[model samples]
Target: EKWAATRAKYPPTTLALQHFDAAYGIQLGHLWPSVRAALLCERKYGALVNNFSDDDVLSDLQDQGCRDFISDTDLEVHLEQISAVGVEGESSDLSTKTSDISHQQLSPLQISRNIKCLVFPRGDITRFKPAKPDKFGLLGYYLMDAASVLPCLALDVQEGHNVLDLCAAPGGKTLTLLQTQCLGFLCVNDSSISRTLRLKRVLHSYTPKPFLSGDNLRITSFDGTKWGEIERDTFDRVLVDVPCTTDRHSLVEDDNNIFSRSRTGERRRLPQLQLELLLAGIEATHPGGEILYSTCTLSQTQNQSVVEQAIHLAQENHSIHLQVVDLKPLTHMFRKTFHFAPNLHLGEMVIPHLAANFGPIYMCKLKRLT
Candidate 1:
């Protein structure tokens, strides 16, 4: 009852409507009657619009010739704005047209099976039940979505391009990069040896190849902070998915008992480590290559602040520059809490409310321009 009252009292404002119209070159008053009606109702009647059913309000607008609603362009712009506002990440103007890499030589059954496992899988009923399910993955486990994984997978990883996955164990993002089948030689390192072995087990589930079967893929047990000892500019693409406070997960479960003090510590410790890992990843990345830094937390300190710090470090020591990628179209729900630094551009933080399946995850794609 308390939750319901809180919700009812603080409904989301529709500020995006104005921004949407402005972005798409649509006249707010004339585009859709329903939208216009809602606007006028909110302006004149104020509290009355809250009582009206969404269907009724929309139907009334439709009847009034508000047919030309915002287009996909507007939707994309609105989504970008929200994500930009929520997290300090910049959205790229990169085209969505992906290249066809599907191999025709593989049998149809094999292809179908691979696609099924890659895209969708039906498991036993028992798999659906969690043994120790928290909103976020516990300890070395992390549940991530395509928004965080896709950009890493799409990078052009040519032959002989060294790659690194710092803090990679129970590796989902690491697996995505491997699936691209482009790394010259891959290094999958994690601080936990047991988790690294678990990652090996997960990799075994996929089809075996020279990369998987041979020593081409190196699995190391080491701290990510020490990864800077590796030769500078050695990797083509480096992934830094750091550990964070997991505050967003707090909303889904009653973990007050276990997380109370630890959560506070995480808020402080995560930003420091995040910035360190990014510096290590940037140093490890080949000049003109890309580094993707991600975290499964929502704090601006861990997300925006770390990226800004890395950019500053790069400017001071190396000639590296950071380019931001926009992530608005994919994350539509949480636009309110996004924050950014005035000087630094690129990277984003996903808020808890925006994610449908996972807790908040922040991602930043940066190209090393030296």
Candidate 2:
């Protein structure tokens, strides 16, 4: 009612409508009609489109005498309020101790450190689709969270390293590992048969022929919990991108959406399953090797608590030695664009941004001591 009343104060223009349509095209899932009507009633509707694409469209609007177009600079400044952009380390929450990586080994992956490249993954990812689809996906790069890509960097993959991506379906992180460093062999596994097929397709679509034909890649559908008993101490580096409550998929404006039905069930089963996967990754990693545990949720029960419980269980039950790899230094480097959530003793979090619209990822890097 308040928004509607405020919107009534202004009038909509044709250029504004066009720009709103473009934004709706980009975020097709979030087309709330009420919001659209409100945006139309007010002049505030069209500027959201400016954030997703370059200024060429705006230039065209200007040429058409659409003087009402929002400038990119203005959008960026507004976006900062609801975004993680420009946050400094000193201002971070003191409750969560930052992961300390100073004594840890440096990242083996060569990073571009370019803000442009880092921010590209956060944009309307469909823009990354290629004109021609090839095995290499030369133009169709897998779009994923930039923070999710950080786990591979945390692993510090070296040439000839043996790696495992447990629960590796839809192959985004798997692709990152392959792209970042040379590996002797990579074992990709997911428990679901259908998801495994999707992972295989992703691998086949992106990996080159030499890698596919070579004995270096193994794709499997196995119960991930049994991996610790099955492939204990096998991999030089391991990644556990465990399944969790993906909040993005759960968000719906309609009260009657079926998506909420399994929310309780998922929350109930997720933490233990997450711990099982993390422990399995730990068991599979060679002594002195590292494992990167990550999830796409903001739930503390699933993120920090799972890592803490797994660490305790591994020590008490299996008598295995594990160490949380400090990520403080790395987080410091990324503070400007991606400040982590506070009070995390086990990992780093990238909170979801309403404007930027990417991620709610949590990642913890761990090493097997013995």
Candidate 3:
């Protein structure tokens, strides 16, 4: 009855809560309220410094409650190939070392230990909403959850790699990929024209005018699931951050939400679509290439089940093989900055907490072998 009353009070969040209750509320237990209550407060967000340009200084963001680096601690890797881990009993090395990420930069505030994103605690969002320029002119940082940037980092983009961001829209992870400055060619695409336009605009904000349209970068409105046919075995790295329920935003905002009355069918079909996208991403990956599959929601069906099915289908139909890259080492290294969900077979989920309110972002890494 109280939940009914609260739902009546906030119609925007009702459908999401109901769906969550049906989906995984039993697992959430008391943490469900933590997610609910955290929604009422300002969100803790992070800033990714623009590696492309230095025209704008943003030191004032640190004063505005930006506390520390996402992970300043040295990562001690204790990860073995995740056994059975829900994907079947096969195991493979996740393949990363503490020495790989131990490099430090001169910046004391945010050591450039590979991932240069900054963490801001709650009650510290005044700088992001209106985007406070502060005393250092325009802020040089791109405001986002520190968690959303993980997939791009884990994708391990390198110089001269031909990269494809298949479902890239509103383009946040795309920007993080750009920060690497390692791409020989980048194709950013989405099925939605509006989203593709928004992605183009996001690129425009951070990218130089000349570089946005040349031989290096290309933007298109393509059916993300059909990408394998369009560019077969082409990219060195691929990022398929598929469109999911967007659980956190779905609860807070009602406009065009998947939980809404108009989109119930769309929501139901998401797992199938996610599975197709992952398969297509794998198909587009060159032999010995890597791909990072991600979503911004917590639906188990949309995440692990989809990856499991894709793994099954990829080998069964096309004779392609994918090695699931274990991410336990990465999650543990940044434990202080993120609250990761336990026992997940395919990926890492940053569970939202009232104290550390961020995410519900799930990412799984894979490598395609011919």
Candidate 4:
């Protein structure tokens, strides 16, 4: 009864929404409404992990009536619109919204810039009429957010590089890395069994059986905070895509989300864990190797501050130095199709907005110097 009363007073979106406002108000003020509206809407724009399908997924989707978002002329013009631009030029009033955002015409940008993944124009996704029953049909594009590929792109995995995907759950980013055909051996790990099961299921459907059982890939259930100790100086590239207070899921999904009274305490501890996990990833990287730290939240505590503190602690505590790899060049190259927060020194973030509605994804890349 107390729980019921608490929920009645606060409502589902209350705590999460208030948390974001307090956490991100300085950075997202005035643009928060549209971001809220986009998150509330059900028909979210998502990407097809194209490389999963053997054939050209983009051309196949196009042939099936799905249009490429980046190539859409309307979206291109809307991107630069004076009023409609912000949140990476991604604002709109919730009061002025339709029942669903996808009801309005919006195109999905090739979130990966075709090199990584493709985004579906909002409404056209329902019109996807696949011609054949194969991997493409079995693998629907909407399984992942359009911007999920950002970290993999930033990681820049090279051929025969040893890689670690710490906290790899559901495995969408893992699939993206495979697209590069990089990795002498990929060590995929997630702490949670349920999430790891989902990751296994992803590999089962999208990946070949021979490959899953082969020497190239090994999935482990390990505490990500201890990964560095477990496998020190082991990887050529490491992707520490740590588990976070997933902003979109937190706001829209009240049940099983982090905002509840019982879970909020653990949520409060995320930054510290994030820092430790990042430091562990740093420890796991070979000297002269690269590591990409990422999160799906817009919180500075989770994103920038975590990266900042980890860089200092990794050096001070272990005598290991790391150099920041500038992500501005990547954001600029991807700007035409996606909306990114301007002037983030540590990394690039995809700002959630009405036009692209892709991400609240933030990533920073660092290279081990010592």
lDDT of each: 0.49, 0.60, 0.73, 0.71
- Candidate 4 local lDDT, 1-370, one digit each (tens): 6555544687556788888878677777777677777666653444554455565566766665545443344544543342232223212221122222221112112222443445555433352333232553435343577687777777876657888999898898887776565458998999999999999987766656666775989998989999877989878889999878898888877788888888878988999999999999999999989899999988878998899899889878999987776554455546766778775656779887766677889998887879
Candidate with best TM-score: 3
Q: Clash number for every model?
A: 17, 3, 0, 6
How do all models score by TM-score? 0.56, 0.67, 0.83, 0.81
In model 4, how large is the Cα lDDT of residue 353? Answer: 73
Runs off by more than 4 Å, candidate 3: 1-12, 29-31, 56-58, 67-71, 75-115, 121-139
> How many residue pairs in model 2 have overlapping backbones?
3
lDDT of 3 at 325: 71
lDDT for each residue of candidate 2 in 185-242, tens digit (9 for 90 to 100): 9898999999999977866665565675549888889999889889898898898999
Q: Model 1 over residues 309-360: C-alpha lDDT tens digits?
A: 8888877877777554343332232222122112223454432221122234
Cα lDDT over the full model 2? 0.60
> Which model, 2 or 4, shows the larger TM-score?
4
Rank all candidate structures by their lDDT, best first, as comma-separated numbers.
Answer: 3, 4, 2, 1
- Judged by whole-model lDDT over C-alpha atoms, candidate 1 comes out at 0.49
Q: After superposition, how far is residue 345 of candidate 4 from its true place, in Å?
A: 3.1
